[model samples]
Target chain A: MHALIQGIILGVLTAGVYALMASGQTLIFGIMKVVNLAQGAMVILGAYLSYQLFTSFGIDPLLAIPITTVAMFILGVAVQLLFLRPLKAEDRSELSLLVTFAVALLLEGIMSVTWKTSVRSINTGYANSSWTVFGYQITLVRLWAFLLSIAALLVLYLLLNRTRFGRAIRATVQNPESARLLGVESSRVSALGFGLGAATAAAAGSVYGLLYPFNSGSHYDLISRLLSIVLLGGLGSIGGAVVGALIVSTSSAVVASAISPSWSEMTFFVILLLVLLIRPQGLFGTTARGAI
Target chain B: MQLHNRLRTTSSLVAGLAAIALVITGCASKGGGGGSTAATSGANGSPLIIGASVSLTGDFSDSGKAVQRGYQLWADTVNAKGGILGRKVQIKIVDDASSPTQVVTNYQNLINKDHVDLTFGPFSTLLTIPASQVAKRYGYAFLAPAGGGPDVFKQNLTNFFFVQPAPTTQSGDVFANWILSLSPADRPKTAAYAELDDPFSAPIAENIRTKFEAAGIQTVYKQVYPSETQDLSPVMAAIAAKHPDVIIGGTQSVDAYAQIKALVQLKYSPKFMFQSNGANSPLEYPNKVGAGNTTGVMSSADWFPGSKASGSDAFTADYTKKFGGTAQQVDDNSAEAYATGQLIEAVAAKTGKLDNATIISSLHSGSWPTVLGDLSWGANGAPTGEFNLVQWQGGKLLPVYPSGVSQAAPVFPKPNWGG
Candidate 1:
């Protein structure tokens, strides 16, 4: 029972970072209707960036988040402008998948050349520090990462709810034609939305590097989990991504602690399958229209 | 009509160029007679061609590169000694990208298409398995440096020869024997396992489990995490909850770091911890985690720098001088690769012929000496060698067991994490 509770706490804290990463995938899907398969690659790129910053300049990975996010945001905007922008509107959704995959491969190639596919982790002074509360160990890095994720998510919420650009983004999601008719530039919104998505991934990646050892190939696993979370939460919904990440991570942790580690990976797909069976539209998805 | 005609000509021209490009790429990928040209034979005194597909770009790149360097070091030294049997040795390495399918394709290209005189094995056991099959089909001798799993020996391939200690099962027994050597008061009462779920690692963990249980240690927590697992917290948490005195498992370098990090964060230090692959090397363990973090960790190794084995110091020095790394960086994988080359040279010198069958037969029958110790292939094509019990002491991996090879006294009840 103690193990179960501890696993749940670990899972919940881990879910915060996963939520941050999945939120980006959800946002990109919401705004552009493109799955943005490169989301994981962007996260890896962010990690590498953080690794470099920490190693080269002795900057803490947590502090490197904003710089990496800005850098990834620009890269995301450029990617959208260069690749997604060229596709015809009729073929955009299907072709974007292939194009994003190409971008992912491109990033992977660059990272392989640069980092040589060796696994690296960021070790800060406080990386291994933890506190015990009520007989439970709370790692300092995970606690900080969770707090940072919540703070970032809150900032994202404010940006969406209390800003003009946020209003334009919501408008575009609801009705692209109506939003365009009202003088909101859909292309600009998409570029910004993609950038925002990438920014979220960057933040998550910084936290991820602190938590896990990573390499260029890590994105493959990250993207799969992100896709599962986004799909389980209901495509393009931030709230759904958060809930989905929490459920997936918590269940996996609980199963790992209670049953066995072998069954932990299966728990994700099993829950995904059950959710899909019961609610075809997803946990928070609408049958009539996609919600963000 | 003009526009349509113009489009037709342009499309035809594009198709023609595409076909030509495809043809060129096809020829380029076959490695194009390079091996064949080199293998023109003992008669013409051309270089002896040896081909291998190494993982240069993927998950196994670190081990792959080390193996490649080992081969190069041997090749350079042999060439400097006026070549192997009066012919310069040429090694052709293609990047397998850590994929078994690619390894098979690379070997096929080397044997069927390139027609190299001999072949060397790839990095890991999983890769070496399929690669040996390809060599067997082509009737070429494959000397494996990095791969030695019980599964490979189980294949019973005549052409496949492994130079490492007999598989995880035997190594597990060696480790168990070492553990059993501990005095009753000093021995661990409880044990736990956290292993990587891969072909090479999983069996080692299983063997360790069987041996640990046989020794009457209370088997507490045993879990196998997926390969490339980034998060080990939950697994560590579960293991920590059990409060086992000894922890043993299979982990790669990166995973070892993760495990150490998790152990520290959880404030759960088992009295003793042993990781199979990565913990044996200082570059993989103590250097990967900060120095203080790995103080009391133990690992099983095929080769240790502390060995009094002949040529060990010379090989280590040459490797360091050539590879531009510390002497400690030259571990079992690199030493085995160098040994593979030395064995080939020895076989060539003794047989006085580069014939594949002659070399294969010689390897099967003879006891050859190399930098990594004596090599004698058993009926199963696995070499009989010792697996040294090594531990991290003062940031260096010192051999602690097998009395003859002991570099330092085994530090038990490893210092508190970060103390």
Candidate 2:
């Protein structure tokens, strides 16, 4: 019973970062109707940027988040402008997959050349510090990461719910043709939405670097898990992504602690399978367009 | 109309002739001087080619580059010493990218396409196991410097020779015996294991569990984590609940760093903690996990910094000078690679030839002195060498086991996490 509770606590903390990362993925899909395959690569790029700032400039990883996020936002906009904008609207969804994959490979190649594929981590003074409350250990980095993720998500929610730009984004997602007729400028919304998605990834990447050692190739694993979360949550649904992350992480941790470590990886998929069977559109997901 | 037709035919003939000429020249340039039958004998004035496929860019790139450097150092040193058997040594290396299938393909190209006279083993048992089979199929002698899996020995290949110690299974025996050497009262009573789920690491973990249990240590917890696991909190929590005295496992450098971080975060410090591949790495281990945090953690290694073995000091100095790293960076992997080269050179000099059969026979019959130590092959071409237990003390790996080879005494009951 104690182990189960401990696993739950660890899982919830871990799920916060996964939720942040998956939220970016789903957000990109929401606006563009094209899955950004390079989301994981962008996250890793953000991590490398954070790692650089922390190591060379002596900036704290958490403090460097804004810098990385802004930089990644610019890069994401450029990518959408240069790569995604040129694709034929009819074939954009199918071709964007390949284009984004190419983008991922390009990023991976650049990172490998710069960092030499060695696994690196950002270790702050408080990286390994933790608090014990009621016989439960809560790591300082995880707690900070969770709080920061919540804050970032809240900001995202506000941006999507309360702002004129958010309404434009929603209009674009709902009816691209109608939105353009109404002077929404769907292309601009897409670029900004992509940038916002990348910005979220950057924020999550900073927390990830502080938590785990990563290399250029780690994106492969990260992307697979991210895709699973996005799929399990209904495509383009932010709330659904968060819930998917929670369920996936908690179940994996609980299984690892209770049954065995070998079964932990399979547990997520088992839950995904069960969830998909019961609710084809996911728990909070809706079939309606722009329902995010 | 007739004149135009004649002109077209003449142009077509000229273009076809030029294309044929280009093809011939391309093949000629690629063939490397008509494939001289006396290439191995140096009769054609060609260097003796020793080919290898290493993980140049991938997860294992660090170790792969080190092994390649070792081979290069040997080649340069021998060429400076007027060559081996009156011929300069030429090493041909291809990148396998740390894939088993690519390893096989690289060996095939090296042997069947490039026609190298001899082949050295790739880094890691995962690559070496498959790469050695390619050598056997091609009837070439393969000398593996880094592979120590028992599965390779089980194959019973006649031409394959491993320079490292026999199988990682023996590592468990060595570690168990070392633990027993301590006073009974001071020895660990309970143990835990968290091993990487991989071909090479899993065997070592299982063997350690078996041997530790045989030695009367109660194994309170044991689990295998995925190779790419970036977090170990669940495993650490489960182990901590059991209150084990000793925690040992097989982990790569990244996994080790995660494990250490988790241990620190959970504030669950075992009396003794050790990781196989993680601790052996000179740079990544201490660099990732702060040296202070890693103090007193034990790791097994095949070579140490200071040794009185033949050519050990000189090889270490030359490797450091040539590779542009500290002397401490030259660990068993590089040392064994250099020693493997030396062994091959010695065999060539003694036999007065570079033939595969002669080299294999020489290796099977004689014990050769190397920078690593005196190496002798046992049944199934497994080399006999020492696996030393080393502990991190004040930011250096000090040999601490088997009193005869130890440079320092074992530090028992590791200090508190931050102490």
Candidate 3:
């Protein structure tokens, strides 16, 4: 029972970061029809940046988030403007897969060359520190990461719902032709949307460095999991992403703690299989989804 | 129309002629120059190239990176001393990424393309299994620095050599003897009740079972979990329900870490929890799992910096100076990798030849000083060395067995245990 409770707490804490990362993926998909497969690589790049800042400049990872996010945001804008913007609308969806995959490869190459493909973990003094509530141990870093993820997601929600730029993005997602008729710049929205997606990755990346050890190629695994979450969350829905992350992380943790550790990894895929069986469109997913 | 057709026909004919010439040249080169070049590359003059395929990027990256560092340091030191056998040596390294498919491909490239005389490793048993076949097929001297799972070395590959002791042959024996040393009444009844599995842990688990059964201890439960398992809770809970007096962790570090962490969280403290080589590298097991939690957990070790073994003090001093930290059992890995170079050097000095066959023959018969003391290989290519048991006490690993090597007494009557 204690293990179960602890597993739930761990799952909940981990979900926040997963939700943030998935939100970016979904956001990009909403405004653009591209899948943006490079989202995972961008997350890994953010992690490396945080690691570099912590190691080289003695900056705390949490403190380095603003820098990493802004830097990645700029990178995302450049990528969309240069590589993603010029494709014909008809070809955008199919071509974006190859383009984003290329971007992932490019980031991986730069990271490998700079860091030499070594797995690194940030060992803060509080790495092992945790708080026990109701017989559950919650890692301090994980708790903070969870709170930070929620805060970031809330900010993202407000930005999309309460601002003019948010209106434009939503308008474009609902009807691109209508959005263009209203004089909303679809191209500018795409560049900013990509930047926003990359921004969330930076936030999640900072917390990721705190929770796990990573290297250049870790993005491969991260990307696979992120894709699973995004698909399970219904492709372009931010709210669906949060729900999907909870289900995936909670089930895996619960299985690991209650059923068998060996079966934990399989549980996620199994759940995904079951979900796809019943709800092919995903829990909150719609057929009329925007580009990645 | 006639002019256009004629132009197309001439271009096609030119392309066909060029293709034919290229194929002829390729066949000629393969039949003659390829053989000559390969012969010259392997002949008396080319620099000896050694290759290693290791996980430089994933979970086992720490161990792989350290081994690489040690390998590099040894190579650099040797080259600085005028090279091995007076011929310059080059080490070709590839990242196996901890995957078997990548390992096989990398192994082939290293052997066939890089033309390394001897190869060191793609660390982890998963990668080692497929990679071993590459060595067997090509007859390259494969000196594996790590990856001590039983199946990896259980093959008929005479070209393969292990730098570490087999898991079952080491940990299984240690745990069984320790169990026997306990009073019969104190010994838990269900041999079947305690289960352990890790691809690397299996040998030790099997060894433990064999030793217990041989000693006439009846085991009531047994199961083997594949290495890919990310959870061990169901097994642990089942064993706890059976109320076994001890739970042996046929565990590597990650498995051990996960198992112990789970055990503490689940609050299913066994009478004892014993770990395998995977628990050897990290010196902070007690701290990681909490001091009292791992107090009575027993495991065999190849080296303990705290031990009073012969030359251990000198090793600690020199290694500490060189690495900027105290040498833990994990250093045994780097030491073995370094010793591979030294052994090669010793053999090359004797034969005065850098060929694979000559070096292998010499290596089988050679005995040399190593960080672990005098080192020699058996006909089976496994190390002809003994290991000792150690228990974690107050955040330190204390050698507990083989009276001569022990530095501190095993802290029996652990802080919070059934005993």
Candidate 4:
């Protein structure tokens, strides 16, 4: 029972970060109908950006998010406009995979050259400070990261539901032809949506740096986990991504704590397989595009 | 319209799967560099081109770059001192991106297409195992820096030599034997082991676990995790629950940093902790795992800038001069590579020959001196060497084992994390 409770606490703490990371990938898929495979690389890039800020100027990583998000947002827009915008509609889905992968490779190369491929971590004074509540330890950095993830997810909800741009993005997702006819500039909405998605990477990335050591090649492991979470929840559904993250993280933690750590690595794929087998569209995922 | 919609949905799933598979592949070389010019004769002849495949862009890129620097530094030193046999040395390096198959292809291209006069080993035992096969097929002498795992020698290739001080399988014994040698009060009562499931990390960790058991230290817990494991929080949580007196981790720099962070978060500190990789490197440890947290953590290593081994001090001074870093920051990987170069130079000079067959035959018999210290290979190319156990003290990795190399006594009941 002690191990079980600790696992739940660790799981819940971890789920928030996974949800924040997956939400961005789902958002891009929802709005642009393009799978941004480079989302993981973007997150790592954001972490490096925050690392530079903290190390160079002594700015806190959490405080550096606004700057990194703005920077990543701009880069995302440039990428959409320069590389992704010109693909013909008939081939957009297939071509974007290669294009985003190319972007990932390019980002990886730039990061490797810039950072020298050595693993780095962002160490704040409070990175390892934890609270022991009910005889179980909870690291302060994880709690702050969890709360930040929740706050970022809330901001994402408001941005998608309450804003005029949110409505435009939703309209474009529902029916591109109809949205364009309804005076929504689909391409502009697509570019902004992609930027918005990348902005989430910046938000989660700062927390990620505090939690884990990372390098340019760290994205290879990340992309797999992100894809698993996104796939389990149903692609293009942000809510589904959250649920998927919660289930996967919790199950993996529980298995590691109670069952076996060796089995925990398989826990993600097992749950993903079971969920995909039962509900191909995923829980909360709609057959059509209205869920955005 | 309905079929097209289904096709789109199906494509999304396929794309996700394919994207995951493709990125995980980590293939795609950064171009096979160097013009396809076949290397020429030696012994005061044209430049002797040595071709090697390194993980310049992918998972092992950091170590690959270090190896590259080591090779480059050796070439610079050798050329400045008048090239071996008075023949100018040229190195042709290509990126394997850390893929095993890609390593094989790189060696093929190096040997068959470029026809370089010599072949050096790639970064890890994983890559070296396959790359060694290609060298064996071509009968080229393969001297590698980091491929010291047990499996590499299992290939029974007479041409290959692992240049490190010891193979990874024997790496843990120095630390484990040291723990056993301590007084009963200082010795750990229980030890827990966790290792990455790679060929390099697992054997070293498992070997330590066996030593602890044989020495009567109770085994508390053991686990082997896939190298690609993303979240280590659960593993750490599980381990802390056990509360073993000593923690032995078989991890490289990234995983090593992650394991320490996880344990710190869990607020569990072992009395003695020995890491097979990360804690030994001053350059990698303090930056990733906070400087204060590194104190008392022990690790095994083949070489350091401080070692009194032949060519050691000169390599450190030259490296600092060339790379603009302090002597303390020159890593074991670069030192290992330079030693490999030293081995090559010694054998070539001794034999007065540059042919692969002659080099292979000479390597099996004679003792060669390198920055790592004296090394000799068995008939199967396994090194007759052992690594020094080092501990992080006062923000430096100081040798603490084997009185011959001891700079300080090993600290038992290691200071807790963040102390």
Considering every candidate listed, which one attains the maximal DockQ?
2
TM-score of 4: 0.82
lDDT of 4 at B256: 86
lDDT of 1 by residue, B109-195 (tens): 776566777889998766777778767655677888876765678778877778765554455555677888889898899999898
Off by over 4 Å in 2: A88-91, A175-182, B1-62, B79-119, B126-141, B345-362, B365-367
| lDDT score of residue B236 within candidate 4 | 76
Q: How much does candidate 2 score in TM-score?
A: 0.87
What digit string (tens of lDDT, one per residue) describes model 2 on residues B275-338? 7767766666777877678888887776667765677788888888887777777756778788
DockQ for every model comes to 0.52, 0.60, 0.12, 0.47
Using lDDT as the measure, name the better of candidate 2 and candidate 4.
4
Give stretches of model 4 more than 4 Å off: A81-99, A167-188, B1-144, B157-160, B341-369
Better of 3 and 4 by lDDT: 4
lDDT of each: 0.80, 0.80, 0.69, 0.82
TM-score of chain A of 2: 0.98
Number of backbone collisions per candidate: 0, 0, 21, 0
Worst 10 residues of 1 chain B by lDDT: B1-10
Model 2 C-alpha lDDT per residue in residues A1-292, reported as the tens digit of each score:
7678888989999999999999999988888878898999988998999999999999998999989999999999999999999999999989999999999999999998998786789988888899999988999999999999999999999999899999898888888899999999999999999999999989999999988889899899999989889889888899988988888888888888776888998988988889889988777766767567
Give the candidate order by descending DockQ: 2, 1, 4, 3
In angstroms, the error of model 3 at A108 is 2.2
Poorest 10 consecutive residues by lDDT, candidate 3 chain B? B1-10
Against the true structure, whose lDDT is highest?
Answer: 4
